[model samples]
Target: MNASDRTPADLLRSALAADPARPLVTFYDDATGERVELSVATFANWVAKTANLLQGDLAAAPGDRLALLLPAHWQSAVWLLAASSVGVTVEVGGDPADADLVVSGPDTLEAARACSGERVALALRPLGGRFPQPPAGFADYAVEVPGQGDRFAPYAPVDPDAPALAVGGLELTGVQLVGRARADAAELGLAPGSRLLSGRAYDSWDGLSAGLFAPLVAGGSVVLCRNLGELSQEGLDKRVESERVTNTAV
Candidate 1:
């Protein structure tokens, strides 16, 4: 782990500095037969735009709580990093009523309305499509995100000691989050440039580390798979070979 990396966003910047063209997150939805590969540059661009939207359009400030009501998809990963970039505390599957802002998927829009603050909804379609009819009372993330600035600069610097994540009944500061991710990476034997295929949900700390942060801090990549259980053993083996996966967390 890079000793200079004090936050998750720092980890991403270090990855970008290492090799912008390297594949960072490759997402697959077995149920929909969808696959999308994002290089470090591409993923960081998305993170920047989303971060701008979160801070500028949504009026989010450091220490603000955001309820992220999305599944373990690639876009969810993008939102995770975006929130971290701006120092927003992400609550995985958190209660909407208590959040200062909320991001929801199509499946959780109804529940996310409980948030009295700003709300954004994601269609979660292939290529990040928008809702056929934009949901009422919530901005379409795909629609709004495209117009945001490509470069993000948070108005206030992030505090590493401040709370950054809350999930699985555990709350961690930025320092704690990155530190744990590094530990998990070592425990999972992930090496630099390793490709990890993760089939874990994002509702717990284990899933967050394995699916996103661990590989990231390890200078590796993630093949995030949804509904992977539906794949046959042979199919899964073929995928492992095709993606050159070195580790797995399911």
Candidate 2:
């Protein structure tokens, strides 16, 4: 695919077609002693299922705003790509009440309830297990998403010029997002096959770029660390060595 005509979804599709077996996201939660690795095909499967859930069940339309109230975990990454594939606008940490749908973690239960639209709650448990019981007003993501289709086709074509993401006071179209990510990947010295270890939170431009978009654009992968403060320098070093990380962003 030509770079000028590419979107984030296009990048992901290319990666899947090029090397479906390559590791796409490696997640670590130091506090919980959790480590999970998802290959490109596995990650794409999750994205497709979630995208189908959004489109088929939730009835999310292009340009619809989805409030993402979650941390920098693997599931959060899945939702990001799912929303992008369906041409939904992701508002990271946005006010749930104003969004067309809300996807939240246990920590944001209250805020998620305040949202009048459809709601999905992730347990964020190890292995992405289902919640003990469904959260009051929301569907359990683990319970619902798995039953959705494994392939996704948006109801309408995703416009490259449509708004795709809004975070940290920046609103970006699909093309702009991919272009910026490509530029940022070059600036960060990311090359194909690079593995980037990022302990930074996804609350700002720097963190999001390094932790997600840049890696996708550069045909690299990310080792995303949540609760990074819980790991000592020695632990971090060991993780970097074990994961064979080629770059670091914190």
Best lDDT among the predictions, by candidate number: 1
Number of the top-ranking candidate, with TM-score as the measure: 1
Model 1 over residues 45-151: C-alpha lDDT tens digits?
99999999999989999999999999899999999999999999999999999999999999999999999999999999999999999999999998999998889
**Model 1: residues >4 Å from true position, as ranges?**
none
lDDT score, candidate 2: 0.90
Pull out the clashing pairs in model 1.
Answer: none
lDDT of 1 at 157: 97
Tens-digit per-residue lDDT, 1-250, candidate 2? 2364456788889889889999999999988998899999999999999999999999999989999999899998898889989999999999998999999999999988878999999999999999998888899999998888888898899998999988899999998999899888998899899999999888776788888889988989999999999999998899889999999998
Off by over 4 Å in 2: 1-5
Clashing pairs in 2: none
Judged by whole-model lDDT over C-alpha atoms, candidate 1 comes out at: 0.95
